[model samples]
Target: MQCPVWIFAACQSLNNWQQEAGSLPKIGVLAIQGDFLEHGKMLDAISMDWQEVRLPDQLDGLDGLIIPGGESTTIVQLMDIYGFRDTIKRRTREGMAVWGTCAGMIVIARKLLDKRPEPLGLMDIEVSRNAFGRQVDSFETEIHVASIPGDPVHAIFIRAPIVTNVGPEVEIIAEVEEGKPVAVRQDRLMATSFHPELTNDTRFHELFCKLSGS
Candidate 1:
């Protein structure tokens, strides 16, 4: 039987990603907190080899690392308990690409409006935690990313943070409001206020893979 148009298109897109990405890089998903399994599934769909990163030691030799969306405070606390802060910084300095989603974005920001969570100060942006209000205010929308071409990316924001201030080196990839940035990238580091793993689209994953030099 012939597949539906949407299914065919999805398969075509996945195949195209596999071809363009060429030799998928070994990626690690921070599994200490949040919806890490969802990120893992997305990686799997793209035929990328990945593992759950709970300890700092597991970061060795990884081409890329993804900090999944979860409670920012809890993720940071677990990172401290597991001694991941310094190691992650070292790895990133060694040219390992990093992507942060939702709460992960807040964890990597240079400055956060909230004082509770001590960010990694990796990305050159100031974030306002829970900028979209409470969980009840969560919503999704289609947005155009500057680097990723074709269709607009489907972004899901759940108590998401917003980039209130961007530094000179940071590149604003996507924005919800005229001046509010929802996604930003700096060198090998990237961050998104929305949860791309929750969506069926794998373009973000593909983009990260390319960024990691897959």
Candidate 2:
């Protein structure tokens, strides 16, 4: 007996009937910080879904998060005001990946050398905030990504942080000519002392997404 066609189809479908978690990972950008819109656009260009995480619920099921570059002090203040610091800590601790670029690095620094107010203290590394001069000293460079496909990435550093001290678990990825650490990765988390979103190149973000498996 052949049984019923629908019954056979259902039997075959049962092996692959699991529901999807929805479109690609919902990347969250801390809107309270600087360059949030810019990063949002980058995400859109890459065809990845993203949202400005201004509330605690926004971080609920994000596959990955981005703390965009901005003023460190003000960014931290907003994080506290919106109660995102605690949520970020919880998510990062539970194996959710995070990428902190420029001022984002300072916000997640566990040990900030500069004499600024406390931060979210997310990463376990020491950072020197705003190593580059103020607005006048802002500069851009083509950074070398060891595993990238083509030429180095064009990174824009506007009052970016300098990773002077990375913990044993942290792996330094890229640096400037002066040996200033620009990119560092600790497990699934990543931090850059520059703003990749501000550049036309998308290597940095692609690399980050690859690492996040999203």
Candidate 3:
């Protein structure tokens, strides 16, 4: 006897689910500061395996890492205190993917217009911190991203940074204004000026997971 169409479809769906579960990447969320818990919840919603990465050693075996939105200066300070600067760079060189959001973007940029906190110099982009003004000036808007399909993404900018310049390798994913980039990707590295974790959308997280080869 042949399987019914609906039964076949259900079997295929179950097989896909099993494959996805088997290939789920072990992601790490930087928990030294910021909204790491929110990112963890987002990962949970996607049914991806993830954990809070507090120390540099926690980075081991992680397919990807997320730097959550918070105080850029404080995040950088804690990173240095925990000896993460070199270790993270090394991991990235070894093909570990990284995604940064809001202040996390500021931490990973190659250059920052403001002089103070030292960036990890990961992504080849220059950023202007607080380009959208203070927390009170925070706003939400829908923007189209080149990599994400379907409708525009709902971006929440809270004291966001804007990409002042991008290198040849960097791909501009989304922008709020002409000539200003809010989301960018370079190989396995990604950065967003808005807090995607604060919104209901999981496309950005899905994109990062895909980029991580999960």
Candidate 4:
């Protein structure tokens, strides 16, 4: 017997809609600290909608989240105080895409080189804070991210963390200085030791948006 063609067509259309609906996925930036406003402006430059996520409730309905660069200890303290640590972990477990930059990378790492507040431990990587040097040592360089198109990306490293090791599941997206990985990805989670929001480029954000289903 021949199946109804209209039913199959309608189902296909519905699937397409579901997929395309996320083309402009709603994103959230952790506004508890760091350059979240810069991230917001970057999102605007890319023509995507984003909000400052200052509370756990703000995490709801977000396709993806960005934790910007800031003082890792203070950020962790605030997250703990506001009960965002566990909430974010749960959301990531449910397949919410997340990207952490600079101090944000440290906050999400699984291991730290120093004794400090516990991070979200969502990314399976070991990090040494300020590996590049102190604030005075901040500098810029161009590196190619395999996932991003076009020319090399201009990376701004300000008191950056260094990824000393990565789990077997992690993928190194970019690196510098004798194969030191600076950007990495594991499933829906991404982390970079440099601040992409500080630049005018949108490739990293665009890549993250794609990961978040945008």
| Candidate 4 ranges beyond 4 A from true positions | 1-22
Misplaced by over 4 Å in model 2 are 1-23
Worst lDDT run of 10 residues, candidate 2, spans 10-19
TM-score between model 4 and native:
0.89
In model 3, the number of clashes is 0
lDDT, each prediction: 0.89, 0.76, 0.88, 0.86
Residues 1-214 of candidate 3 have per-residue lDDT tens digits of 2333423433343346548766657889999999999998777666668999999999989999999999999999999999999999999999999999999999999999986688999999999999989889999999999998778899999999999999999999898876689999999999999999997677788778777864
- Please give the lDDT score for candidate 2: 0.76
lDDT of 2 at 143: 82
Clashing pairs in 4: none
lDDT of 2 by residue, 14-124 (tens): 222212323345678888768889888766656556788889878888878899888888988878888887889999887777899988888887888865758776777
Candidate 3 pairs with clashing backbones: none
Q: How would you encode candidate 1's per-residue C-alpha lDDT over 168-213 as one tens digit per residue?
A: 9999999986668999999999999999999988778878877887
- Per-prediction TM-score to the true structure, in the order listed: 0.91, 0.85, 0.90, 0.89
- lDDT value for model 3: 0.88
> Which residue pairs in model 1 clash with each other?
none
Residue 112 Cα positional deviation in candidate 1, in Å, after optimal superposition: 0.6
- Quantify how close model 4 is to the true structure by its C-alpha RMSD in Å: 8.7
Best candidate (score: lDDT): 1
Identify the superior model by TM-score, candidate 1 or candidate 4: 1
**Model 2 deviation from the true structure expressed as Cα RMSD, one decimal place:** 9.6
Best by TM-score: 1
